[model samples]
Target: MDGKKVILAEPRGFCAGVRRAISMVEQALDYYGPPVYVRKEIVHNHHVIRALEGRGAIFTSSENDVPEGAVCVFSAHGVSPEVRGNARGRDLRVLDATCPLVSKVHQEAQRFARAGRTILLVGHADHEEVEGTLGEAPASTIVVESVEDARALDLPPDADVAYLTQTTLSLDETAAIIGTLRERFPALAGPATDDICYASQNRQNAVKALAARSDLVLVVGSANSSNSVRMVEVARNAGTASHLVSNVEDVDVGWLDGTTAIGVSAGASTPEFLVDQLVDRLVELGYDGLEIEETATENITFTFRPVWQTEEVVQP
Candidate 1:
């Protein structure tokens, strides 16, 4: 123990939803055999996707890329009706691996759209999750990426509107956008518990706490993970120097040489092994003060298979 300290943010890796989604892929492979094609990355981590690929999961960026009559699994980020339609058209045996939380947001979108409300989806327009949520009602939904987008919206002054959000966004950022949307719409409708996932909020909150007592924060996650990126933002916003690394190899000891205490956190989809690697590397570098700082306890778990999986079909 070289005397410097390491603090681990609580509720850091593999949230319930991500765990459920990955399990679906693994189970599908066991039941359906080799060559189970998965739509998109399944989760945002490249290492995760690579590991699944090694297990015989084929990842295709587009639904059309899968051959006809093949077993296809949707990624955890969810997908649009158009993608669903494409899968159906190709006669793919589709097993949806979407997190139920995301499905809930889609349900809200559909309910709002059906109730004749113009939907304001608050999220990055290009994110896969947002694209899927917006596709719930293409003609009735618009994406508001920021406060400016909310302010510049051109809907009729008296138009009925409801809003939903991408699950991986920061709670504060989404709230600010929602605040602006409400200011514009006067009577904007929305979800009761907010669409940002519980796990995302927890990791961010944990980072805030860790940042306060540490000189540097290390967020173990991937570049494409929205929640991972947001965790870095949370740490930085809390007045600590932070870096997002895919793993320990990406860690620059240079960022920690002068640091007395280090805060460590991981994205929802990040594997626990990566966090372990980071901690081990830091100890090797002489930062041996170790402490586990837990900001929350997550007991939530998902228990159900996608409806599509239950349908009677030929074994592949």
Candidate 2:
């Protein structure tokens, strides 16, 4: 196609929470020296994890792997109370990096549980965030991944229930599931605020806007990043072809064969450098024209806890 263009979505890549989380790890490495232990994938992006690892951050799936009294930073996805307890028992010097948004969801779960309501958590069950949220009140929480799952809930219509969502879910999809719950349980309770994170909502809306005018959409993020996958889904649901591009090498030339306008966006946890690389590759392939699709302006920033900047350990 002649004069093919790249339409980049505004407010894409490295949301405030991600920036805070990554910065905490880097700061820890600098202050605590090499081999600062981190639980989980930090923020679900391998590139970020690898970069931190190169700088002496050690990632482990379990807190037990961290040596006693070593510095350990929690991932942005957050951890369950049990995980926190385990870390404490090890006497690990902890630095919490959980995104404030996800922490809100966890608080909602605990509050609902305290009220003796059966909490219905909506999102992919296998996701790290979902797993951690579920652990908040495992005995009283049910994981609902889809509207179909909501429909199949075995609870009575009048059962006491409250629903919370994984922060990084597709806004439309989460709404549908919540709608289903409301229809089934007239007395269902929910968070005073929307559980979906602002970054996710903004990125999804931007992707839909991009899908409206582009021949194809490419979301830059790791495969495991829920928000990035949701952006791709948002574009496809808007009737545009979309794919998740982990990096420039993942782009298939055939997808761009006749595409005149390709939309580009990155997940919340993605770094802008990946987007730059993808854009550079697209330019080399002759899609040099560039336009920005500004659906939203994100000026939010998250600050690290006081303990993250000091030598004192943060009690879990």
Candidate 3:
């Protein structure tokens, strides 16, 4: 393993959305004291959830779990209107931390429903963001999980339809599925801009590039992170071995036994510190030389706005 080098990819971790979501929790804790109830993991990263838990953030699967009049923050994945209604019923001081990009998608869903168009939402049906978006027009929305699902649609050929995609999905795969849908539905409309988040797209592109020359590529992100898993898939599709890891502890030393070169990339929700630790561990394993593969530069930042910017505004 001696003298082996590792290539890190640019724009690998902490997209603006995740950064803004994490900051909302931390800032809520700072301004409102301990016991800030956050509904669901603020982002997909467990390490991030644990860190915030240590800082006095309480995570609950449902907003109904929060006590009356307590502070509750929605996750970055956004929430269904039913969840928001539940929060209101509980009289919790809600601080919605949903990513603005996600919010934009939600607005589009509502607009399409108003126009009486059946929606073809492209994503994993069970993801929270998908669930939330589906709630916008449950009667009018259809979940498109794969090309097979797109083909199995029972709607009429001339039906009015609009297509919206999940923020974190395999770009190539999604494109292929959309192509199938386009062939089947001539009047299909799409979002004004691409729905795949910029961070997700950049990270996946970098992983594809890294996989081209590296013997093995390690992606640092939790299993639940969609973008992270997609990055690994992209690498594998590029004809290289790839693994999804949460941190340095998850990196198996054996993968490097005979490897001369390695590639590392992270999901948007992953913290840079995790990548730093992975690099350090790789160094210890004899893959010392490091180079950052410049694929893209990200300078985006999101500013958060609470439902009500006060420590004690009880109703929302």
Candidate 4:
């Protein structure tokens, strides 16, 4: 299409949590040399993982895979108490890089369980963050995956219950699920603040706005990234065609056949460099005009206590 443009979404890519998690790995590599063990993909982005792997970061699915007494960093998605215990048992020098927002949900789960309330956790059950939160009080926690799950709950109407959500879920969908819970459970309690992370919320909102103006929207993120997938869903729900592009190679040329304006956004865990690559490809594909759609400005940053700053927890 002649004079076609790309409308880039602001507040897209690299949230504070992802930044902090990645920084932890990079710093660990710098300070500890090669073979810094990272449990899981640091932030759901394969490119990030690959880059770190190139620089001597070893990604493992479990802390148990790491050598005893070696440096091991937990992913941004977080690990359960059981994982932490296992790390301690292995005598691993643990550097927890879980996002603070996610850590908040874990704390809530523990609190609800301590109060003897059955927890109804919202969001995808299979996600690492959900798994970690569930681990907080597995006996007392039940995962509610959808509005249907919330409606199908068989808990007694007067049962003491509390609700918590994974930090990366879609705002609208989570609201619908929570609404169903509120209707079914009159005594249900929840976090005073919303559990969805600010970065996830902001990116989704920006994508929604971008979808309204573009003929197609492409989100740059890995396939397993929850927030990236949700952003694609949000755009589709907004009545626009959308796709999740893991990199420049994933963008389909045919989707632009009749499109005039393309909306581009990235998941929170994604790096802006990936978006830049996509934009470059778009420019080469005759969609040369470019404009930025600024929906929100994000200035949040997360800092963490380094592993060296903490006492070693070697197995006795």
Top-TM-score candidate index: 4
Model 1, residue 232: what's the lDDT?
A: 96
Local accuracy of candidate 4 as per-residue lDDT tens digits, 36-86 = 999989999999999999999999999899999999989999889999899
On the 0 to 100 scale, the lDDT of residue 302 in model 4 is 94
Checking candidate 1 for backbone clashes, the offending pairs are none
Per-residue lDDT tens digits of candidate 2, residues 201-297? Answer: 9999999999999999999999999999999999999999999989999999999977999999999999999999999999999999999999998
The residue-by-residue lDDT of candidate 3 on 12-74, one tens digit each, is 899999989898888888888999999988999999999999999999999989998999989
Please give the ranking of all candidate structures by lDDT, highest first, separated by commas.
2, 4, 3, 1
**Candidate 2 residue pairs in clash (backbone atoms < 3 Å):** none
Provide the global lDDT of candidate 2 against the true structure. 0.92
Off by over 4 Å in 3: 1-3, 306-316
lDDT of each: 0.89, 0.92, 0.91, 0.92
Question: Which portions of model 4 miss their true places by more than 4 Å?
Answer: 311-316
Off by over 4 Å in 2: 306-316
Candidates sorted by TM-score, descending order?
Answer: 4, 2, 3, 1
TM-score for predicted model 4 compared with the true structure: 0.98
User: What would the per-residue lDDT of candidate 1 be over residues 1-68, giving only the tens digit for each residue?
Assistant: 24698999998999998998899889888887889999999999988999998999999989999998
TM-score, model 2 to reference: 0.97
- Candidates 2 and 4 compared: the better one by TM-score is 4
